[model samples]
Target: MHRAERPVLEVADIFRVHGPAWRQTVQLSLGQLKVMSAIEQCRSAALGGHVLRCSGCSRTEIAYNSCRNRHCPKCQASAAHRWLEARQADLLPGEYYHVVFTLPAVISAIAWYNKAVLYGLLFDIAADTLRTIAADPRHLGAQIGATLVLHTWGSALTHHPHVHGIVSGGGLTSDGERWVACRPGFFLPVRVLSRPFRRRFLEELAALHRRGQLRFFGEYAALADPAVFARWLAPLRVCEWVVYAKRPFAGPEAVLAYLSRYTHRVAISNQRLVALDERGVTFRWKDYRAKGRTRYKTMTLGADEFMRRFLLHVLPSGFHRIRHYGLLANPVRRHNLAKIRGLLHATATGAQAAAANAPPGNLPPRFICRHCGAPMVIIDILQRSAPIRAPPAQRAAA
Candidate 1:
């Protein structure tokens, strides 16, 4: 007999059961606490939502509204789609590179505590590295455009911080006269990027340190002393700061597929969650260190530990995870794009084509009846179903 399909598991299932206890034991930032609360209530009757009816069968169902919080697992796919469509016009005519810049483990230790300052500096320095290397006469020497998305978690939900950049493979000449494409398969030399990136980042870090802008805490408190901090950074200069550029994407479609996935990815998705019971939470994660079959393994962590790993990724409030730079920077993208388009229009082959992105102001029905496979429409409204209340034990722990 065919095996029965396992019921879908969500982050909320674990959060609802253990969030209060976890919160009481561990001191959490307001942003992390808010994220936990939102995830727990997302799509639950506790948050008011509407009743929906299938148009064909008239089968009614209560569809609770989503919290629409960025970190919530259920909310990002639509958000990524809409964001991709809205920025579709930003696509350059040629191939794009998926470049990734990762912070070393030592820096990540500092980054965990000084998130806003360090993360922002990471973006700025990464962007500067790309633009600088690309603009050198020996290299591409043209002003390229890039869309950078910040990701803070590794597959195992560890605090491995990195930036994913979707960059145009080519760029415009200084005078805005023509497009300059890089060597066919390669975007930029990885070794070249690594050295400069490390140098620039360290300089920025030292500057931040010198200016008394960086804060150290707990065990890292010794880094508050400039001498100790400088000593801490000395080894980083010689180490290989990972700056890798993947092969160029085939075309615009590949770029869109990539953006759709990475731009809004949370630390973990619901689909990866296998079960949450007395044993603990079991989730599928890729062990990048292992080979083939050994790579895909399920890890079971205690509720407290799982929640701790999840909270490690909660970003500082109001920090923009997705950013644009170079020709794609907000201030001058329109004019710069027009210039690029003009250069494309002067094409010798007349092959380059233009496309406009038209995003719908209102979204169509997303939910469908499992029984009927027909679209479900909202038929009625409902109020909050239950208030999230902490237990006496949890309150005492708090």
Candidate 2:
């Protein structure tokens, strides 16, 4: 059984109440609650699905259906596969890089109030920054393709909003006659990208304020004043917004692996929930900046506090976390991908063509019965609360 399937009253059980409470209170965010609930219900009868039985012994078992929501940590494997399959044809014969653009604490606070608007602004600004920088004569001088995903929480479930980007390391020149590749290991100057991102984001934010599209409340009420809002944004002018570019991925396969791991992750995984008691919840987290490979650290917080942290990540309803830009943009993606594939084929020779046509890695094997060590077959489907009849006992002799 998965960690989440264990008994209900264990220390880990704190997450159930804590996660939901936080979301309901709006102290924690909605995204966290949906993800937590999905994790708890995964492979369980609440979803009402069939289970596998032993073909030889006729041993029965129960299987639960999945929520299949995109953000569900337990449900993204198949979803990612489907997405990657569609994106396969868009691959160009070139390297890819990962870029992250992080909003400052000041902006993050504002974003906590105006989530959908500001989050959408972040995507547009960052994407525009990359496209504009790449198209500049001094840069790659081409139209780049990028995939952007929004991540709203830090490892500890703190409300730190950021955007993760997967970008082609090169792009087609404006004329489309030839491809313009970036430096083998470098995509763009972080400083340049950061500056443009801040500018575009602030410009749009100002426009929104002017149009009376932003709402301020509680401690943020001061932002409703134009002068105060402008003053509040002043510090960001000199502050360096973080723009990180990691080394190029090993290949397309590596990129997919990264996405599978990071894309669907929730506020906290079941494995991370160590114990729950009167002392609150104990959980593990990674301190990314620490050296000596001292990766895992444990934290304990009050149940209410834990819930508060977890719910701070819920996204607005109907908001999309993943987005495409440039050549991958929906309007012209089909045409762009076809053209790129043709270019790749023209460049690939005999051996490369053969390798490209090779089948991908096989799927992981399905769950099997431990008693007989054989593949289990499904014989019946059951929904929750479905009744079953028990056999009558034999009559006693006089």
Candidate 3:
């Protein structure tokens, strides 16, 4: 007898069956456990959903609900699209820069343990570094704005923390009266950005350590010693930290398109996932150090190991990975946006400004049926895996 071909696999498939076993071997943090549960249930019938009936063809389909967890691989695209649409108004009619700040190996080790404390510091310090360097008279001497997104995993699912920042190539002058543009082809010097970035991050990290705010576990427990931590950070102080700024973007549209790719990204998208079976979980990963075909490689880890690596990226609860800074800071973004537009005399993007200012629920529905090209009405709603009911004891008592 011949066997039929196997069905294509999904991350959910792998996680659902193997995740529990992996959890048995390790004591996962509440955040990690929650992330695992979300990824496993994402887009499945277990969660509530709605029925969409196409009026044109009289075709009806059941759409499963999204888990909406930031780490869910299946849900980030929609989030990114909505954000890009909103960003239509945030665009400044000038060159924008793609800058990335990476943590060094020594500090990255600490970040692996004390993720919340160190990662938060990284975001703040990186933003402050950009603003401080930009404000110097020797540079643009203007207050810049940035959209910062933190990415905590490497291509192979390792814990490599970094921030990808989208920065305006120009900004408002100190008096907020005029826009100050950088040189046509360049933003601030990477060297200038790197020094302050390294200084500020290290300073804040040390302070956190001194206050015992940082955690060290397993092999890193010795780092809790201030002297040992100081020695570990010493090499980083003099060595050049990685702060790279690409050439200025062609225009604002290109900036938005570029940012949409990075802003809502999770560890690995579904497209990159290849197969999972008795052999293990195999996926494609890019080796940035290599050239051409050699750069692309497939890695297969045992099911348990794969889950462990995936869980490494589970963020602490309520941590905001994407943030606005300086002139783009949430509180002053609108007023400052108006000021910059006034100085530049650029045309408004669309009704985006109005749409953004409108109350959340006041906006119309964003979802529409693809088949009929019409608005989808919720004909029915599904519930979660658990049915809505009291236990037998409660029913008996009543």
Q: Please list the C-alpha lDDT of all candidates, in the order they appear.
A: 0.84, 0.75, 0.82
Question: How well does candidate 3 score on lDDT at residue 256?
Answer: 75
| Clash list (residue pairs), candidate 2 | 11-276, 28-311, 28-312, 29-311, 29-312, 29-314, 30-314, 31-314
Candidate 3 lDDT over 153-191, as tens digits, reads 999999899999999988888898889998998998999
Candidate 3, run of 10 with poorest lDDT: 386-395
lDDT by residue (1-398, candidate 2, tens digit) is 22135433432256455654554554333455455565556556666877677765777777677667554545666566556655555566678999999999978887988999999999999999999999997988999999998999888878989989999988888877667789998999999899989888888999999999999888999899999999988888888889999999998778877887666666666567777878988888888888665977899989888766765776786898889999889898777766776765645445344444546764333546667666677767867542211122348998
Winner by lDDT between candidate 2 and candidate 1:
1
Please give the lDDT score at residue 339 for candidate 1: 78
Clashes of each: 0, 8, 0
Model 3: CA > 4 A from native: 1-7, 351-354, 357-367, 387-398
Candidate 1: misplaced stretches above 4 Å? Answer: 1-7, 346-376, 385-398
Candidate 1 similarity to native, TM-score: 0.90
Model 3 RMSD in angstroms: 5.6
Candidate 2 structure lDDT: 0.75
Model 1 per-residue lDDT tens digits across residues 1-398:
11123348889889888886777777777788788878888877788888878877988867777788888888787688668766767766678998999999999998998899989988998999999999998999999899899999999999999999999989887887889988888898999999999999999899999999988899999999988998999999998889888888888778888889999999999889998889899999999999989999999999899999998998887999999999999999978877787877733122122224234555545777767777887777899875533232334553
- Which whole-number lDDT from 0 to 100 does residue 99 have in model 3? 92
Candidate 3 local distance difference test against the native: 0.82
The best candidate by TM-score is: 3
lDDT of 1 at 213: 90
